[model samples]
Target chain A: MNYCSDCGATVSLKIPENDERMRFVCDTCGMIHYQNPKIVAGVLSVRGEQVLLCRRAIAPRYGLWTLPAGFMENGETTDQAAAREAHEEANATLRDLRLYTVISVPHVSHVHVIYRCELVSDDFAPGVESLETRLFHEHEIPWDELAFHTVRKTLECFFHDRKQGVFPVHNLAFTIALPT
Target chain B: MNYCSDCGATVSLKIPENDERMRFVCDTCGMIHYQNPKIVAGVLSVRGEQVLLCRRAIAPRYGLWTLPAGFMENGETTDQAAAREAHEEANATLRDLRLYTVISVPHVSHVHVIYRCELVSDDFAPGVESLETRLFHEHEIPWDELAFHTVRKTLECFFHDRKQGVFPVHNLAFTIALPT
Candidate 1:
């Protein structure tokens, strides 16, 4: 950060007294600007043996398929965020949502949480951020076009555990590949 | 946030196109600064039948008993943050850590994650952030002097699950009490 948001003063990167890490400290306001990892909450909507996937219309992986997800906003729980993302991206209503996976991607400074939710109905369409939306059975999933590793991992676990007839919450992490 | 950290430009609080919530937006830099909930990662270190607790030396609950926990910093996973908090608050070494509780405090926009850990040794003392450290059995716990609800909830879950002989990861949420 070049300037402190609190005071509009120039900031310096220095270790504060009694602290081990270097942080952005403001010269005028004496404010410490600390940045931290964010959470991306979404849903893995299930209807019978099918799951919902949306085609991204935005950049960074446009045209690729992804589950409905987005950066969580303040004042909402992870479950609320996941449901909201589902509505916004795929126009899907959810019911009986359960936390399924929590994955930390350190490379991107994000923790992704996906819920296993029952689709309220078979009716769904693409929202503004999606080019298209559809339900896919395991055989019809476009594995090669999945938008993120978190999505792939959650789906893989979901299908794997379905065969076992028991679904346990997954607490997992994966290192994101650094930019070339 | 008043000014853009990237360009030192005054920012406006407005809803961007296709976004439902208002955010701090810098017109000059086209930067949208969004605030989201943070994860407070900690450990519930158990030994035999006792659990570790630390008395806070910091404000916001000075001298109240709590488990070692703090905000998850950038570039670190939840596991690392939990371990670091243990070291920084109680000078405790922990092992065999397993994700135990995930509680969403939406009113505060924070998620508290606690892991079930085994204390490496009982030779820990109070760190700078802690006034005193001690091990507490179920009956010996200072129930009336707990620092936060998440700590109380985690401890309750731990003790309850101990009796059941099966400790499944808890995904729970509680409405945060509004600040007075």
Candidate 2:
């Protein structure tokens, strides 16, 4: 941050008194600007043996397949955020929402929380941010075309657990791969 | 926020195109400043049959009892944040950390994530932000003097689950009650 949002003054990175970490402190107002990891909430919407995926029309992985997910907004529960992402990306409604995976991506400062829920019906269409929305069975999933590691991991766990007829909440962390 | 953190420009609240929420838009640079909920991570550090508690030495509930938790910072996983909080507030080290409760306090735009862990040793003292730090048995807990609802809920779940000999992760939400 070059300027302070609170006072419109130049901000300098410095460790405040009684604090160990360096923060963006305003020169005029002395306000500390803190940046935290964000939550990306979505769902694994299922119908019979199929799971929903949306083809993104936006940048950063456009045209790639992903589970409907986005940065969670303020004033909403994780469950609510997950449900809203489903509706906003695929026009899908969900039932019996249960927390599934909470994956921490420290490199990107994101915690992706995915829920496993049943599709309300087979009726769903691509929302504005999606080029297309469709359901795919385990065998038909575009594994290589997946947009993110979080989506790929969640799908892999879902299919693996389906065989055992039991699903458990998974806590995972992702580290960025360094070039050898 | 009154000014853009990117450019030192005055900002106005407006909904940008293709967006549903009102966000701070810079008048000069047109930067969109979006705000989201933050995660507060802490630990329920247990030693024998007792859990650790810290008396606040800061504002918003100074002198009240609470678990060692604060706003999670960037470049840390939830588990790491929880561990850091315990050490920072109570000077306590933990082991066998497990995800416990994920509670959404939407009214305040905060998600409290508590982990259940075993205390490494009985040697713990109050850190700078804590007035006092001590282990408290179930019967000795100061229920009426608890600082936040999230801390109380996690402790309640821990004590109740102790009887069943199982500690399943909990997903919960808290709504603010309007005063009559």
Local accuracy of candidate 2 as per-residue lDDT tens digits, A34-148: 9999999999999998999999999989999999999989999999999999999999989999999999999888999999999999899999999999999899999889999
Model 1: per-residue Cα lDDT over A36-151, one tens digit each:
88999999999999999999999879999999999888898889999999999998999999889988888778999899989999889999999999999999999999999999
* Stretches of model 1 off by over 4 angstroms after superposition: A176-180, B176-180
RMSD of model 1 against the true structure: 1.7
Q: Model 1, B90: alpha-carbon shift in Å? A: 1.1
Clashes of each: 0, 0
Candidate 2 lDDT, tens digit per residue, B75-158?
889999999999999999899999999999998889998999999999999999999999999999999999999999999999
Supply candidate 2's per-residue lDDT for A140. 96
lDDT of 1 by residue, B1-180 (tens): 889998888999999987778999997998998899999999999988899999999999999999999999988888888999999999999998898998899988899988899998988999999999999999999999999999999999999999999898888888846869
* DockQ comparisons of all candidates to the true complex: 0.79, 0.89
Measured by lDDT, the strongest candidate is 2
Q: After superposition, how far is residue B71 of candidate 1 from its true place, in Å?
A: 0.6
- How far does residue A77 in candidate 2 sit from its true spot (Å)? 0.8
